[model samples]
Target: MDLQLKDLKGIGPQMLHILRNNGIWKPYDLLLNIPKSYEDFSITSIEKWHHKETITCLGHITSELKLIRGYKKDRVHFQAKIYNHTIDIIVFGRNYLIKEFKKNDCVLIKGTYDLYKNSIVASTISRQDKQIEIKPHYRIEGIHDLKLTHIMKDLFESQTLPIYENLPKELLDERKLMSRREAFYQLHLPQTFEAIDEAKRRLKYEEAFFMHLNMKKDEKIETRAPKPYDIHQVRALIEKIPYTLTLDQKEAVNDIFRDFKKPFTFERLIQGDVGSGKTMVALLAAYAIVTAKEQVAVMAPTELLARQHYQYFKTYLKDVNIALLTRKTKDKDMMKHMIFSHQYDIVIGTHALIEEDVLFKQLGLVVIDEQHKFGVSTREKLIEKGKHKDVLYLTATPIPRTLAMLTYGYAKISLMKEKPKRREAILTKYITKQTIDDMYSMMHSALIRKEHIFLVVPAITSDKVTDNIETVYQEIIQEFPHAPIFMLHGKLSSDDQDRMMENFITTPGSILLSTTMIEVGIDIPTATLIGIYAAENFGLAQLHQLRGRVGRGNLASFCYLISTKEDVERLDMLVQSDDGFKLAEFDLIERGPGDFIGHLQSGYLDFKYLDILEDEEIFLTAKEDLEKIMNQPDFNSNPKYRYLYKTYTKQT
Candidate 1:
């Protein structure tokens, strides 16, 4: 109500929604959202414009205007020929402008000139009185230009302008940073490119600082009331496991054991790649703590994963009581009784494990599988539940090297480079519709060899994807009518999914057609053939995981990436690179910032336009600024820092 950022006098609900979606709701939000690049249109002569130069022109339009209706609606355009140009000027989507031109005796247009057409098409056209107004245009969203222009125009004329001089002016001098008002003013209404450049530097630095500050704040909060447990007890338990832990895994386990022995709480992220044996490492950490006569809780992303963990724990630690806590268990009383009686030395489940009622008698360690699936608040809740205990987060999504250092700075890392002995490199191939028969022949051969199969669909039952599983299932049934097929998706009941997976796993001749849900925690040794339709549709990390599912078996498993030739070419880049870390980097560089980084990397931070690949130097600089601010709060308390702190705090 008090002239908030998007609350500019003329902005409506629709525009407000757009602004908020783009992380702009307050005046500071607008200020912080700086343009990536500027369009220079200061050239004034027709001769320079006719060089086919794309530049902005500011001038009053001659009274003459032309409205020509062509054969097509799209072709029907407004022609406003400039005073000096012989060629006609075409304005696309300018109905209102055409009507206004007819009614008005005066006009002005600002746009880029095209010499090939010998005309200057308007980027913006307004009356002479409004010609001096500054507008903010973005490549992705055109709405920002209108909203930002009105807001800046009003702010320049209003008394409610933000107090830029609030922060200590000396900090600006020391840091060689711009003033708060100057930064905002330049970003929205830059007189020169230098102003825009300075604004970007200031805003990026601020965003990075707040990110670091929040992390440190969370870390400080997590470390309160240090609790320590016996490390040898957990170690002794891990020592009994059959497989030898990798060096990185062993080191991470030892470091965690050392931290667990401390009186203070330990919260660390276990960074490992897919097939990195993260599960075993986590088991070791949990086993060590559990051996100390303390309870440990493990949470996975999906029911399949939870059940998988439960199966492993139940089988490996048959002597130790392991309780299953998930939504699927039939007997509620059994779950409650086992939990209350302390019959379970370790609890394994999904989100159910984090429920308010699932009490841990002595929650010594909390292990989260696929840590990115849970949001920050949810993870915080889990950490809070394990008061005075250690937190070991496991993620298969490969974290890029630079971001790993910044975001996971507090946590020690472990690598799972080596695959299990006898693990076959799943021969990955891409096929188009033309080669469908050949692909089918290959599947039949695998089946003849007594191998199982997994046919992965990209969508769920209810949630509409580009291509539906029902359609794919129909095609598969039609093509291979003799083979049995099972279906799994998010829409299916947990019981149904579990049953279907079991049936497919046991039934040698059956094929399991499922969403990416079948990617993790489902180990089918005989599943030698895996097929994913529209292969390029999924991210490289996910594609790798799905491929991993089939290759687990000793037999020479194959992943047939079924798609068009074009898609196959796109996917070939990933198919050639088996290194998850390298693939992750390639994926990051290719996709850029429009996609969610954390969602793929299991809780990685996705900064707007701050690509970890291209903007590594800037990322580091932002991180350094944040650390410096945290260490020197008094320095941030200065007036120059006030705008930044206020902007970031308001947004976060």
Candidate 2:
């Protein structure tokens, strides 16, 4: 049999199961499990040993080894005399070591030295001849260190590693990169630090290179027949709005129009901060499609957001036949027939819009709100419902310019950085737990003025509670006994959630306690105050989104970040600025690209080593290399590139 992981000498059935659980089912997988860190086992003099530092000392066990019985177990203790110093050695779990070592026996002891006890807690004791120059430390769980080291050593000495060189020869030569076999060997067992560093660089480049290739494959430019639309009708709809369009909004609308004029199907991303009128841009695009006699579908991630868009569309496009389709729609069959029969010019809904049976009459434009919340496959499924429909992705979570260039490099992008002319800037403040009484007093004043409030928490129930909704809900109701307070969370039934939201919207001076479910979609103009509990627990982008729930109207709005003094430095960034794009850049820098873009979208990229935020140079280099490679005539025909493409596709 081929030497698989199970073929290893000590790997029994239970051991094989544990190895597979850590993604090491094959020998190659085990080889790829590079060391998380390394320990230098070079012998050090006892006089040079530092406290809390792991060191190996060549010494003689001058005193007799004794087994000391403690409350837990027998501990083997001995005193070692080294060059000018006497060091005590203690072994906690190895009583047999007492008989293994005798007085005046020279041995090598490796462990961490303690200053308080003037002793070393021995992790491993070996003959001086077996001392190593450097030891690699792995991150595998539920495995003995010595056993893993022995297995790895055996594999390295006996087995031949799989050699798969994917990079072009010229590029490899120019970059001075090592071949795949050499890189793997050096990564697992390097003679010097330079070798390990070079190996890491090669691996990081491969990660970035493959990621770019996968993204390029997914971003194939399609040549779809253009659908002619009247530009004057779109302009007329824009003019009908009560407020004039900002320059950014006008530019964004013009960009969409330009995209519609192209012969290819448009894939565009429209990003705007809160209250920046992204809905207006979407509405204008819908109007253009409707004017062209083509149907439009706008999908939001949640029902509340879908309803919000439905209301906005109905208010603006009164003559256009628009309908809402959701999981809870009263007449599902009728709604499906109406959508399929072209009874509606525009349809807006949640994921229900992408159902296999929810066919579109003619889906010309597909607008996805909070696009990061949904996976790429979900977006593709909805667009597939239409025949080469132009996709307009709407995101309130502002992305940094660098990130947008790298992640959405293949797509047309438009920005709505400017807010409406009348929208007021929200005042953000960071307060501590002691200041709650004062904040409640202010809330009472706001309530008396007929303004609604939102208390956002991190969790729903008190069991797994950190910034819990139930706890805050009880406190708020007790503080203001006569005030109408309601609780909303993901655990609640859809009907109950909708009722709570409706009640909060219809009732003035109402307080609603909710989780971050209200972070994106639902908007109430009367919601003048937002108190976020454990604000430091939220990302800046999320806090920005929660703050956006208010300040939708001309009313003066306030967002209180309830946190401790320790979190002041981080939360101060939110208090100082309202620009979502700026905050997004900061968030990216502070929390990394995965946390900023969210897991759903980041999982699509699936980069192993390159960080989109920190490894910009590597990413750019890889992109350039990919572009050069794609220009080659044999790029697609090459077996290496094909393999990489196939592997990435399967993983994603």
lDDT of 1 by residue, 81-137 (tens): 344444444566665655576532444555656666666666655554544433456
> What are the lDDT scores of the predictions, listed in order?
0.68, 0.83
Best by TM-score: 2
Per-residue accuracy of model 2 over 1-652 as CA lDDT, tens digit each: 5668878767888879988898888888887788888776777775777889887888889899989989987789999987757989998889888778899888888888998898999897876556656667786778765567777777777765456788767767888888877887776766777788888888888887776777776675678777788888877777788989999999998899888888988788898888898998999989999988899999998888899999999999999999999988898999899999999999999999889999988889999998878877888789899886888888887886547755554667898889887988899988988888868987999899999999999887666445697678778878999999988998899989988999989999989999988888777888899999988778998899999999889999899999754888889999999988888888888887666666534423565555666677877787788788678787667775686546545754
- Specify the poorest-scoring 10-residue window by lDDT in model 1: 73-82
Task: Compute the lDDT of residue 586 as modeled in candidate 1.
Answer: 69
